[model samples]
Target chain A: MAVKYYFYPLWLRFWHWLNAVLCILLILTGLSMQYSNPDFPFMRFDLAVSIHNITGILLTASYLIFLVGNMITGNGRYYHLNLRTISTELMKQFKYYTLGLFRGEKPPFPINEKRKFNPLQKISYAVVMYVFIPLLIITGWALLFPEITIHDVFGVSGLHLTDLLHLIIGFFVSVFLIVHIYFSTIGATPLSHFKAMFNGWHKTHD
Target chain B: MMIKGMRIQALIWMFFFMIANAGLFAQQTDSIPENVKENQKCLKCHGNKYYSYYNDWVEGDVRERMNPFYVIDSAEYYNSNHKTFTCIDCHSYEYEEFPHPGYLRMEPSYSCMDCHGFGDEWAKFNFEEIQSEYEKSIHSQKHNETFSCWMCHNPHEYKISARTEENIKEVIAYDNAICLNCHADIDEFMFIAERENPNVLETHDWLPNQALHFKSVRCIECHAEQSDTLLVAHNILPKEKAVKKCVECHSDNSLLMASLYRYQAKEERNKAGFFNSALLGEYYVVGANRNYYLNLISIVLFGLVVLGIGVHIVLRIINK
Candidate 1:
């Protein structure tokens, strides 16, 4: 038997889709800038730059919305990292993905009202949202006002360093997106997790 | 990895080759070329101050004024930096008789580019682009008949001026002197323009503390091409196209960088074609240059993120 649970809330689903679209747009435009080859066109360089800057601003606003919504709705608990159980839970999740997943064993910890994410999802989401996203936004703003943000930190040039950091973080975000997509396919059915994200109900084995 | 290593090695070899060639070329400029040595006969007359006297009368409305001809001071000529060159070196016209037929008005004036082209040994110093730029200049287009290199540079006394760290003020004075020769005096400026226009000071009245700007910056810094390069392109822009934006020179990636902070590596002049924060430290250009420590932290954090992800992937696969 299977039971349907309201795992994803309305605002969370909206934020998820909005964040995904913005990330995809940013990555495409960012890649175009990084390579800077006219022959390999994602779009015209100037157009891409304008769109990228505008999307980055919108993404920052959306991120703030996510943060505020999480606080007000009490859904932030799902993302809170419990350091004691994290290691053990992470190992169990890792084993399930590699071996037990193929053996058709049940999920070690199922999603409910209190626990919205599996252990691995919780940690990855926290890092991506709390750490990487903020870094990207800060670096993006620095790049926008290069005259103000640039300085000599040690002997190295500050603007050069900012460019380098932006590139590195962009790479990580790109990799994370790939991993996230792949992990989304690991539910009961390949489309089940995606459907749950689109609506609010997720089916769990009993 | 192998390809990348080979590319690095190639760059290193190329760098060394450039350094070696630059040193060898620097030593060769000490001696004058053979062409200047062959024109002694023409030099004997023209090099003498007494030989420069002219009998032409000035047609003045008030009783025809007898303006005595000014002579080319041979003593000054000999002491000049270009003393190795003869009169015919620049004249380049036939003069077989005692009273040369084309002496007063030489048929063909030698263009400065005649010896400055790529084939010349001196062209290795990278002045070829300057010729190309000068041809496209508004000055060249508008005053082709009136404009000649001698107007600014005395061909007989031209010497290379060094622009070092300590002598920047000297360099600015020296460079601006060429522009000021005609520009500073109203009579000379009007004579060169060959028409009546508002004087330079009056034209630049829109700028605040315009005299200070004139003192600190070269005219060409704003009047020439707005390139990232430090090299002053010879394309003298028209007043309409001249840089009017105050922020263009004052902000980061300033136009002054190219005019003032020229490429340190003369050989790699093209390499440092764009703005670099490393090149901008002595003079702070706000917003263009950034802090290096924050950059390092960002890089390290990014690396850790990648490592963590890699480890997790490895662990997951290992459990299988």
Candidate 2:
């Protein structure tokens, strides 16, 4: 028996779980604060705002740390797109999800040290981590200090455009949340993918 | 001798009767009260016609409207901080006599230091230093020609509440009026005129190079109200709140509120066509019908909750 070794790094595990928890909290408090309703008793409006700001700062810091860690550990290379391989892998995964899996077919893409995520996940995470997250942070900072030199960084016209883009990106994140939960259920068993996230390893049944 | 004594007695009786009559006349003259006398004096100068006009106006009203120069809500003004003060309180000793000519009603000035007992502190503070800075402002230059401090701030009523939608519209209108007052071509300054004008590149010597589109935009539209003072400042929302505000406007559907349920199903599709159809349906067909979407969303959310719990249990078993 050839035992394949694929261990999740300690840093990756920490960042993943921290981001997950913070993102959830951010969404909950964000929803509560937005509506200004008394029903969501998790936190008061003022406290929720405080928590959201603090959490946002922490999330930004954590993302920076994650970026540095990824660069140092060479994990960033996994995100590099090879069009042919990606297209092929994505199609296989899609097919498995839609039709093949019902017939008790095995997952076409195997977990390896170099390629942990499916092609779709790779692309999604790449966009999320590299593009959307950074845009959101920059726009958020600009919005925070309207009296400051935000206009210098991006001109007045550009700032307004950036703000609109930021709002669209936020809508995208909400949609991502709904889709992420749905995809989390698509493993061999409904809980398999979730368990893997916690345990740092998936149990492959032969 | 008896005739002379009788004459002296009659003279004494006449003098006593005269003293009693004088007392009765003095009481009658002094009987008119101060208020009545003041009103009569005011009528003398203002004319009986003015008095009648005032009387007709205030007959059914509790407010006393003496001045017609400014539109004053007398009831609200009387209930304010200056309630105890009469018209003459600030304008004391202005009128030397009834119908005094060239008498100017003194403009009420505010001194926070007076009531606050910080007179010494204020005395040392140079108003000229701050006034010089304000004088340099663009707002100050335009304000000089068309309007004064009274245009924006009520001198008597210094404290103002948060800018309401109506007040914001009024402020914008005032800004437009200020622009038109200086600009010779009033049509050039008007929003619709600017849009229609073919000479967009033409530089008018009369008008400033800065665009007047800002005059059309309401103040509160861009500036958010500060949480503490309710005054519109700059962007004051924290990142989380900003994100939340963005979501509140942009989110197609929200599970957090009952109001958002109508769009919940459309939200899940991630299809532009579905959203467009949903929007059309919502506007044209659904109209006020929201219960259908609400019930559907509740069911879906309930299912999600149950699935999450079930997944949690399954994960626990797998770990074991």
Candidate that scores best on DockQ: 1
* Model 2 stretches astray by more than 4 angstroms: A1-4, A38-43, A148-164, A185-192, B1-320
For model 2, what TM-score is found for chain B? Answer: 0.30
- Candidate 1 residue A163 Cα shift, in angstroms, is 2.0
Give the alpha-carbon lDDT of every model.
Answer: 0.68, 0.50
- Per-residue lDDT for B1-320 in model 2, tens only? 99999999999999999899899988986985553354334434332223322344556523243455444444455434454444444444555343344535444444332343345543433333334433444445544454334433344443322222233334455434433333434453342224333342242222221233233232222222222211223232322232223222222342111221222332543232222233222121111112344335545865775676567546545543
Clashing pairs in 2: none
Residue A127 of candidate 2: its Cα lDDT?
86
Q: Per-candidate TM-score, first chain only? A: 0.95, 0.80
DockQ of all models, two decimals each: 0.03, 0.02
Model 1, B1-320: lDDT tens digits are 99999999999999999999998877775454554445445544544443432434544322222222323444556655667766666664466354457555546666667776657676444566776677788878888888877677666654445333344445567778877777776676676687665667888887654655665567887888854432555788987999876445544445565665454424233233233343344333322333355446656866776676576556555653
What does candidate 1's lDDT look like per residue over A4-25, in tens digits? 8887899989999999999999
